[model samples]
Target: MGASIDERKPMVSGFGYASHSSSGIGSAHFRGRGRSHAPFKTWIWRHWPLLMVGSFGAFYLIHRLSHMGSSTSAPKATSQSAQQLRSDSSRVQNGKVRLSDLIGASIHLSEVAAHEITDVKFGGKEATEVKGKTDEGVDEPVTLADARSNSVFVNGLRELFPGISILSEETDPDLEEVGISAINGVELTHDPWLDLNDILITVDPLDATKEFTENLLHFVTTMVCVVHKGKPIAGIINEPFVKDEAAVWGVALDKATEGADLRVSHGLQPSTEDTVAGADKVVISRSHTGSGADVVSEYLPGKQPVFAGGSGYKALRVLEGDANAYVHVTKIKSWDVCAADAVVHAAGGEFTNLKGERLVYEKDDPMISGGIIAAADSKMHAWYVEKLAPLQSSHGDKHRI
Candidate 1:
């Protein structure tokens, strides 16, 4: 189950101080030492005001010394350490590495994996052997590509931000062992605002695995999303099969505006249009199309349904204005949609559940119940939600609008 909007609130920022204890001589030690205290009392009576001033001056000096030590030592620390100890604490509390840098790494690694997968000769032995089934019972083609890509991303992220937990779809035995080793090598910095355990990174190294196997390269993508306490804060989607090798990323902390124009680095401008006409196109999953097709057809009437593979690719179609909306009425994993969700939201679109609630990532169970909807604009999203209410209410009676 996904977290509610109230449960997805931003975490509070603060550092916790560890407590320590020390043993000391009790008051009984002074009880027998009264003869020595008499001389000290006589001396204090003779110069009480001087002793008082000296005590106050010493206290002030110690206080100043403590502050000076902190100021002087802070700058001398390494950049990573300084960032970890920032006063605001919340800025980089999740990790010292920048989100943009992480996204860049994800794109590069995904592209490398894509090249390996697509370069194989078509209709060859290697191409036929790529198909495999995952524990989830989904036909996961491109096992080699998925393993290599998972290794690259998992190792790269572990090296970049050690101690951050990663929840990835590719859990092959070899990859899991390598990832565990990589995680063990990380030396994490303490953060008060963020629990490293609570910061999860979800990855779909090769989305649209079946499409990639079928040589429908354009529909495949590599996705990475950063979830902080169940909420997605940053993400990257890399379309490695595209001619230009396009990659786009977005940060939720940037305060993305609804229906705002987004100009990405790949020359893709996501539409900000708030209305969809009857002729507009709707993208639906090619592999899991059934009721989703019916709903799209019923809602938009004459709008054509564009069959596409990969949740990321479908969401990208909506973001790129190739499709006015994308709808799915099946259970999808967090990694399958989180990265695309971030990109769509940043691109002035809304990606939410059929109940009109935002999706939450990094839960113990990565499965997202209910269905999902992605629209080019908020108004269209609301319209889809209104239309889907009846289906949602009848679908297992599990979803609430």
Candidate 2:
């Protein structure tokens, strides 16, 4: 049969054909006039492995570049972090002076006063006679030790904190020059007034003047307290007669002051047991026996009373665990107890009025009319307060010695 006109036209196939037949299917075609178009399956089969290798290499290169970028910029990020930390540190330093520096300076001044006082022979020809009044409104004999100690503390602290106001038992203007000259050799590097408010410092140069005059060295202490608004923020009690060289110092837990090392390093842990039920050791004034002693004895039935000479010494007994608590019903001078109060309170103990209220220090009159109580811990303090409540009620609004 002869091919028709339709069969003469070319048909599309895998390869371009010069001539084609419309009826042909799956038959060998004529050679293409230009390039051949291979089947898609055959092309993929020939180049599959090469394509995968190229794609993997490109991906690896991109990953390496990303990691390199991060590594190169690491130093800049670290530098910025370091700068932020430094700024935070500077702000904290500007806020307040270290508590250790204040305590150290106070101890140094106290030691100087102690040396001067110890050198003077009590009741000897060289002893200078002076007199002072107690919180009980009684005249007591004061000595050169009291005056010299007062001068050292007042002048040394003034030099230490130039801007802060100072209140001392020795207010003689005539002694100011002598006091300033006495502490001429003291050198302090820290500025206590840097970030402080209008601070008031109360000083009892010799806490137990009568005891100091009687050569009862154990009772004598050089005391200083830092008062802000109406509260004591920091304080020091230095017992010169102790065999070992140590002083008790503490800052209020809520105050911005730093440096826990300034406090009693070894004996900071207070007694945890109920003082009235456990040790039941109570400290009272040796010279001034107040009515509270009987009340305390009745409350803690079998507890023994331990008589002590100085307010600082009695408070020290509680701090050292020699006595579980110290109770004083008589009127007390603020400076007489303020320093000890700070130390006890800082050591996780309590120091408050007999009525279980906190004591305030920024008063025009330095005398504390209410009785004071110090215990190993707040739990013990509460027990004592509960026991003493009836006595307080019987005595009316104010209890007197």
Candidate 3:
């Protein structure tokens, strides 16, 4: 059982003393023990520790109550900071909803673009024009399908997110002007977070034009990537000719902090395993394997390298575990790799240049000059980086645009 109050020493409580002796007040009880009742000031000085503690608690309570009753007296900066915090939180929540909607729209646009590609590919004979020569000096071709698919994405996205900038491989200045003029009178939807000036939408309406022209449909893809403040945060890739499944994949990241929904659609989602184990095979570009042979032979010694068309297809090969890594030894255009890079990294993989640096999607530069090396995970990426460090500097002007 607990001891009785009289059996214990006196305790200092609040502004008063707690004692078992009811016959005295203040220090009177101590007088019997040779200590006379001290004056009020002396008593307060002797119990200064307790008084200070009590005063601080009361002050805190009053301060809290003042804040609860009327926050107008608080520092102006503090009130503004609290308001800004709430505003940021609201923006993030709205951003998640808008990003989710954007992902859905991207999937639908990809499917629509796929149909456009299919119609053009099988449409008797596709009239082609030599748009220009690639960085590798090969004649780059464009067909009617390219314009149609580009329109589907550019027109759709501009209508949906009118404030965001778009950079497409097949962006026609005249077409853009027409699209802008068309949407000028239309009341477009607005998303506070996505409507910011820093957002960029990049599109590769038809990733493998050469393969598509040659009826090599398996390598064809429709791709799009979303870059905010120079960072690729979302992506979509659609395999138009793959017969297996839905073939459309997408992912949006930064959900917890920036209000993005970390959700991925279909094939772009991360697998159940904590990490993927691989290194036996490497997927290289079929058309632009500039110095891939020597680099792979020297660094990835025993591994087998398979050459394939389309940057998106090569990236998917690594993501689906058909290959451990995807290595490109020549310069690549930004639009060709941005969506693939985003999709690969979003699924717990790594995508970077030969120097082990991430590719930046700046508005002025549309080229990834250092080539690329994408691996399944960090450990595999580090292994590749260590092995391929030598060739990082060898691609001199060949990689430059």
Query: Regarding TM-score, does 2 or 3 come out ahead?
Result: 3
Model 1: per-residue Cα lDDT over 64-125, one tens digit each: 87888455522321232212322211223434544444555565556665665555423253
Cα lDDT of model 2 by residue, 340-365, tens digit = 88888767789998789999886577
lDDT of the candidates, in the order given: 0.63, 0.64, 0.69
In model 2, state the lDDT of residue 109.
Answer: 76
| Local accuracy of candidate 3 as per-residue lDDT tens digits, 284-382 | 876766556656777787787787889888888787777788988777788999988888877877889877888889877887777788986788888
**What residue runs in model 1 are displaced by over 4 Å at the alpha carbon?**
1-97, 120-138, 172-195, 254-267, 274-279, 396-401
> Model 1, poorest ten-residue lDDT window?
182-191
* TM-scores for every predicted model: 0.64, 0.65, 0.67
Poorly placed runs, candidate 2 (over 4 Å):
1-100, 122-138, 173-197, 255-269, 273-278, 397-401
Judging by TM-score against the true structure, name the best candidate.
Answer: 3
lDDT, candidate 1, equals 0.63
TM-score for candidate 1, residues paired by index: 0.64
List the candidate 3 regions with Cα displacement exceeding 4 Å.
1-97, 173-192, 255-265, 268-278, 394-401
Instruction: Give the clashing residue pairs of candidate 2, or none.
Output: none
